[model samples]
Target chain A: MNVAVCVKQIPDSEPPALDPQHHTLVRDGKLVMDESDSFGVEMGLQLVEAAGGGEVVLVSMAPCGETRGLRTALATGAAKAILVSDPVLAGSDALGTAKVLAAVIRRLGPDLVLAGTESTDGYTGTTPVQVAELLGWPSVSFARHVEISHRALRVKRQTETGYEEVTCPLPAVVTVTAGVVEPRYPSFKGLAAAKSKPVEELTVVELGLDPSQVGFSGARQQVISVRAVKAREAGEIVVDAGEAHERVISFLEQLKIL
Target chain B: MDKTWVLAEQRDGTPAGIVLELVTAARGFGSVVEAVTWGPGGAGAAAVLGRYGVTKLYNLGDIGESLPGPKVAAAIAAQLAAESRPDAILIGATHDGRDIAARLSARLDLPVLANVVGMDASGGRLTSEHSIFGGSTVVRAEFTGAVPGLFIVQAKSFAAEAAEAAEQRSLEIVEVEVPDTGPSDAARVVTRHEEEHSGPKLDEATVVVSGGRGLGSPGNYALITELAQLLNGAPGASRAVVDAGWAPYAFQVGQTGKTVKPVVYIACGISGATLHVVGMRAAQYIIAVNKDREAPIFAIADLGVVGDVTKVIPRLIEAIRARR
Candidate 1:
């Protein structure tokens, strides 16, 4: 019942700053665990707690051999972590990421894997299923509720209109949505213990991946140009002055919505 | 001309609105447009699809209780393997659509350009435009490898338009076979639950009133509901309030939630983080009501009110009721 959770260490800013020249996200700062992954970590911890005889492991890919974010995730009770860090891995696309993560999961041989439905920064929302595809494992995305029953995973998967109760066997991947579970705050004791937690670092080569098939060289898509979205001109700003509602109602009247 | 394919979805024989939108987008490629669909609704949707310029409809037939991701992807991949490959595959970024696209990408070892808001096909190459950073920036990208690039397009990115009467032709129906890929396609939907809801669907509402953390307490959310009901609009919540458990995730309007493009969107006490703004910034008109005049939500708002939502909402509700 070993569980592997995919966590992303993202730049610690909302609307992350992009490199002026490269037009890419600036990742050379203090990175933190993406808030989105916190839910996956919490879900993995609870799943292990319910299983009663397993450990939750963290898997990540970050630059500069960083483990700061992984330590935070470990502080929440994951046993250890495996980080794939290499300069060659920079500029990797979603499929490249899925390849690295799938390789790591295959090596660990976890019975079940968990990930956020999408990273707050990237929001591609395709990596977990791609990882499942590469691993030849079943995947259930947008799981609002997940429970293990006799080596089978029962999940409440969200849909466009409602939700569906779905199930799959072990050795599967499940991507949890944000707000699906309340993430626990890291205790002082747990934070102190995280320093001693074992973290194994690997490179693309170590994972038996060719450098040519990763990063910019392996990227299948190229950004042609980047530009700011056309700005909408500010219409009107009115203070409450005890009659702001009147203004809103009048404005809606103009639009005929009222 | 390039061959463009759209993956369509339908429920109970009714095509999802985005499917028609994808069909319209596929036609924009100025290529031979085709469609692939699954479930019992596939056959039922062909006539409407034909009118929308889909010359051929590849039906995967009924997939039973099996989750449609792997099965549909396998079926599409099988078609690609057996026949001439399409130059482009357009799929709506819906729940099952993402799954099928990802699986198909992995199966074919291809790349997917997701969150596409715009597309341009010039010189026989397809370039996709993605709206990012809360729709504040647009990035144009294209695939450097592989044919039939998979694209998961955002809903409502394009208008759904049917063909003219003179151009609507008889559609060709092709049955696709789903290859059994062992346990990888083992997930099954055992039951479905539809949460009780009333009023117009959130994304389809002419007017949308969304509440944020500024509403203070979960009980205060009643103001949002009351106001929305009075306006005949749908009530929405920011991710902050949804994450705080004050509202159902269904009410969430944000990057990870439902993208809403209403005629008018009223934000009550929402600070307007980029995550939440991305979902509603496309509204025809935005009005922000926040005590903090400097809130980001007000930056994009057509009308800005510097006031407390708890105080402003009740007053606004009364005014609307009086008008009625």
Candidate 2:
């Protein structure tokens, strides 16, 4: 079955730098594939391989029309990609992102859609389900294991306690949990092939979306203030010196944990 | 704010721990607090919910084996369409909670403020505070459109306390009629496999011992569980360890994993990535043991120990055993 995987190209940083004036993340810089999306890409590739027919399609949104991250995923094995990059889409919230992605998926009409449980940077963890809802399709989130057969999907969904085997019909959305499958490293031939792969770019207007409904203009929330949290003061730090265990014992004793 | 709603999720015929926490937070909005619950536990949880300031409760009845996301969202949407809208809806940031919130937001064409850690209803408006960059920065945001703003609150963001209602009035439990959500409700659970865990629940434990990549290998994780067992605590793991297949995702503690607030948290070989730090920095006391003294974990750790986890964990385990 054809799979449309939602990939996010986020700023690569330990803690992403924030825009001082806007109180939002600075996304105009170099972008890379979010590590979390790698799992989804790998899962999609495997699903396509198992299906033995349809191809994997990458769907993503990035500011400044950057495709550097999409190329990384393309190198892994996706047939092609659809990138939605526009100045108007700069301050899009989860809902707006979902709107764009849902529109793209609707156009492709893939048998199944895949996404990460959450992005490492934004981490809203809401976009996949939002896309599913907007498309009027069933969604299964936090899937650790997924299998498709006879035009149906079975997923091992993660919960607080363990996992539940969930079944949904075709044309559904499933968000894969990180590390559920090992992502394959791009081979040298694959890397060379990615450069020649097709990437179709689209804009909000081209997608028939209202300007007032897809970006900073369409944002429903405002960041009022941003401030640094009071750093936690460090307590006693002791070297091992063959006596570190005593310190832990004494500390726990003081807390009555011992 | 005239009214607020809390989505009540239950486990084993009892409300989830975050249900009351959401109710407690709803009370702070100075509105008529109402709760919505699905399946078997609403009737049983009403009195306790009332004790925590929920004035009304809505039961959508049982949903059989169908997933709760679509049906629950449709039921709540029906209530909104049939009755007056509330000022806000509070949902826990759990697996099902996110699903319901996303569907509800899409159905209503409204935006949801997620990952909320704190909120204030000052000056006749509600603003939410989100802990970002691994608890290093707090961002306050507010919705600009539509009534009944949706907030997916993080667990342990508020203390759950029980208190009698201000007035001695009986709680009104309303039975909500669910609407057909069509194919959206097609996902069904066929089987369940709950992992067998022996100690206290990870998020509820008074003490938590988490291991990371610093443990070197999966076998070394035994030291973590051993230490936790000796201390009557729970075992946790950083995202790295979980991703490395050293532990289950249920044991993962990070921004995308479980948020824990134990009294004491011991980190073995953890480097304290920002994603992992946000989950446990709320613990009352933190101790980090790493061979690299410059690990970011040391910056926030209440007690930092410079030593190899494989070597130091065994020593600490022996000492604690001797004390007992």
Residue B123 of model 1 has an lDDT of 79
Per-residue lDDT of B271 in model 2: 97
lDDT computed for candidate 2: 0.91
What DockQ does predicted model 2 obtain?
0.83
Off by over 4 Å in 1: A13-15, A19-22
Candidate 2, residue B174: how far the Cα is off, in Å: 1.2
Reference interface contacts recovered per candidate = 0.74, 0.87
Q: How high is the TM-score of chain A in each model?
A: 0.96, 0.97
Candidate 2, A34-61: lDDT as tens digits: 9889999999999999988889999998
Give me the runs in candidate 2 sitting further than 4 Å from their true place.
A13-15, B165-168
Per-residue accuracy of model 1 over A142-246 as CA lDDT, tens digit each? 998999999999999988777899989988999998888999999999999999999999999999999877777777788889999787767688888788988
- Cα lDDT tens digits, model 2, B1-324, are 899999999854588999989888878777888999998766787878878888788999888888889999999999999899999999999999999999999999899899999999977799999998778789999998988999999999998887554642467899988898998889999998988589899999999999999999999999999999999999999988987889888899988788999999999999998889989999999999999988999998988999999999999998878766
